[model samples]
Target: MSSASFSEQSSDDPALDRIGPALSRLRRRTPASSKDLSRNLVLNVIADAPGETTVGGLAAEMGVAQPVASRTVAACIAEGLLRRTASQSDGRRTVLELTEHGETERSRFAAEQRRAFEEITATWSSEEQIQFACLLDRYGADATAWSRRQAASRD
Candidate 1:
C-alpha cells in the first residue's frame, strides 16, 4: 500500500526477501535433502509407462547430471524408498521403483507442503493469489533465463 515499499531489482526479484528464510531453507532441500522424494516422483513417472525406470531416464527428468541422479537413486534405495533390482533384460541396467516406504514418504511430504502453502496463503483473496502466483512464476522463469544467458556469455 506504500509507494516507498515498492522497488525493483536490476535483475528479477526472487521475492525470497519478502517471504523470509523459512520457505527458502525448506526449498533448498528440494533438489538435495528431498532426494528420496525426487526419486519417488521420477519413479511415479516411470510407473505410468510400460517399463522399469532407468538411471539415465531419471537423470534427464530431474535435470541433474547422471552421476548425481545415480547417487540420489542409490541413497533412496538404501532408505527403502526404492529398490535396485537388476533389469531382467539387461544385467548392466538397474531398474528403480517406489517401495511401500517411498510411496508413503512421497505422499506425506506432498501433504506437508500443501498444508504449509495453505497455511501461508489462506488469507489472500483468489485474485490476489492468482496475481502473486503469476508474478512469482515469471520471476522464476526470468531468473533461470538470466542465469543461462550469463553462463553462455561466460563461455
Candidate 2:
C-alpha cells in the first residue's frame, strides 16, 4: 500500500492522544504572569456575562464552589476591579459589575493575549492562524455544551 493510504488507516486515537501533551508543553513554554489564572478567568467571565452577575451565577458558570467564587469576587472588589451595585429590579439584590479600572485591565489583558497569539503564530500564514482560532473556538463551545448535557443527564 502507498504511504498515504497506510497513514490514513492509522488509528485516530493517536492524534487524540497528543492533545494533553501538547497543552502541557504549551503551558510550560508560556511565560509566567503575576496575575492569577483563576482570577483572570473570573474577570473574563464577568465581562462576558449576558446579564447581571451574582456569586451563585459565577459559581455555576465557572463550575467552581460558591465559596471559591465568592472569595474571588471579594478579592476583585477589594482591588477596585469590580463593584457591587443594587439591582434596579430588586432593591435587595446586588449584582457584580466591572469598575472602570476593571474595564481598562480587561482591555489590557485582551490586547496582551492578542499580541501573544500573534507572536506565537508569527510563522503561520494569516489564513492558517484564523482557521486555527475559528476551529478552537468552535471546539470550546461544542465541548462546553456537551459537558453541560452530560451533567444534566447525570442529575
Candidate 3:
C-alpha cells in the first residue's frame, strides 16, 4: 500500500488525533535549548536510577543509542555535572552518579519547567488543572508500560 493510503486508514484514530498535536505543542512550548534538554534529561535519569547507572543503562532508559549516551555522559563529566566510578558490586563496571552541580541543575530545570506549566495553565480552573495533571500522569504511566511490553516482546 502507498504511504498515503496507510495514513488515510489511521487518520481518525482517536489516540493519535489527540496525542500528536499535544506532543507537538509541548515541544514548541518548552523553553530549554535542545542541548540543555539532553543534559537535563541525562542528569535526571542518573539521579533517579534505582541501581548504579552506567552508559549502557542510560542509553537503554533514554531509548537512545549507546554512542549518543556516551557522548552526552562525556560532556557531563567534563562539566563536572556527573561522575563515574567503579561499581562496588562489579569493579569492571563503571557506574554513573550525579555530582552536586548535577543535582542543582536538575532541580533548577524542574523548577523552570513547573513555572512554564503554571504560566501556560494560568487561566485554568483549579479542578481543570487537577484533572489534567492526573490524566497526564496516567498517560505517562500507560505509555511506559506499553513501551516495556514492546521491548520485552522484541527480546
Candidate 4:
C-alpha cells in the first residue's frame, strides 16, 4: 500500500508494514559507527543486568560469540571503560563492572542520543514526542522479549 493509503486505513498490518522502510531510511541517513555502537551497547547491557555480569553472559545478551564478547571486553578494559574483578558471590568467577570512566562515557552517549532525538522531533508537539518515546521504549522491550523467546525455542 502507498503512503496515501496509510492515512485512510486503520489496519494494524499496514501500519506495521511501514516499520521496515522507516528503519531502513533511518539507517541509511544516520549511518552509525559500529565500534562505538558496540561499546555503547556493551556498557548499557552490563549496567542493566540485574546481577554481576560475566563475559559469557554478555555474549548471550549481545547475541555474539563468547570470543567476540571477550575481545570487546578486552578493548573496553584497555580503554578504561570496564573492569573485571572477582565476583563477590563466586570467588572463582569474574564479573564485569563499569569503571567511573565508563559511566561517564555512557552518560555522555545517552545525552548525545537524546539531543539527536530532540533535534529530529523539533517540530513535534511535546505530547507527541513523549508518546513516541514511550511507544519506542515499549517496542524495544517487546522486541527483546520476542528475541529471547525465539532463542529459547531454538535451543
**TM-score for predicted model 4 compared with the true structure:** 0.80
Model 1 residue 90 CA deviation in Å? 6.2
Whole-model Cα lDDT of every candidate shown, in order: 0.68, 0.79, 0.87, 0.88
- Model 1's alpha-carbon lDDT is 0.68
Q: Write the per-residue lDDT of candidate 1 for residues 1-155, one digit (tens) a residue.
A: 35544544322577545665854665664433455456655655555434677887677555689998888877777787788778889988888777888778777766765676566789999788778768877976676567557757876
| Model 3 ranges with Cα > 4 A deviation | 1-16
Cα lDDT of candidate 2 equals 0.79
TM-score of every candidate? 0.52, 0.75, 0.80, 0.80
Clashes of each: 0, 0, 0, 0
**Candidate 2: minimum summed lDDT over ten consecutive residues — where?**
27-36
Q: After superposition, how far is residue 16 of candidate 4 from its true place, in Å?
A: 0.8
Q: In candidate 1, where is summed lDDT lowest over 10 consecutive residues?
A: 2-11
Could you give the C-alpha RMSD of every candidate to the true structure, in order shown? 7.6, 4.8, 6.3, 5.1
| lDDT, residue 110, model 2 | 68
Of the pair 1 and 3, which is ahead by lDDT? Answer: 3
Off by over 4 Å in 1: 1-51, 86-92, 125-155
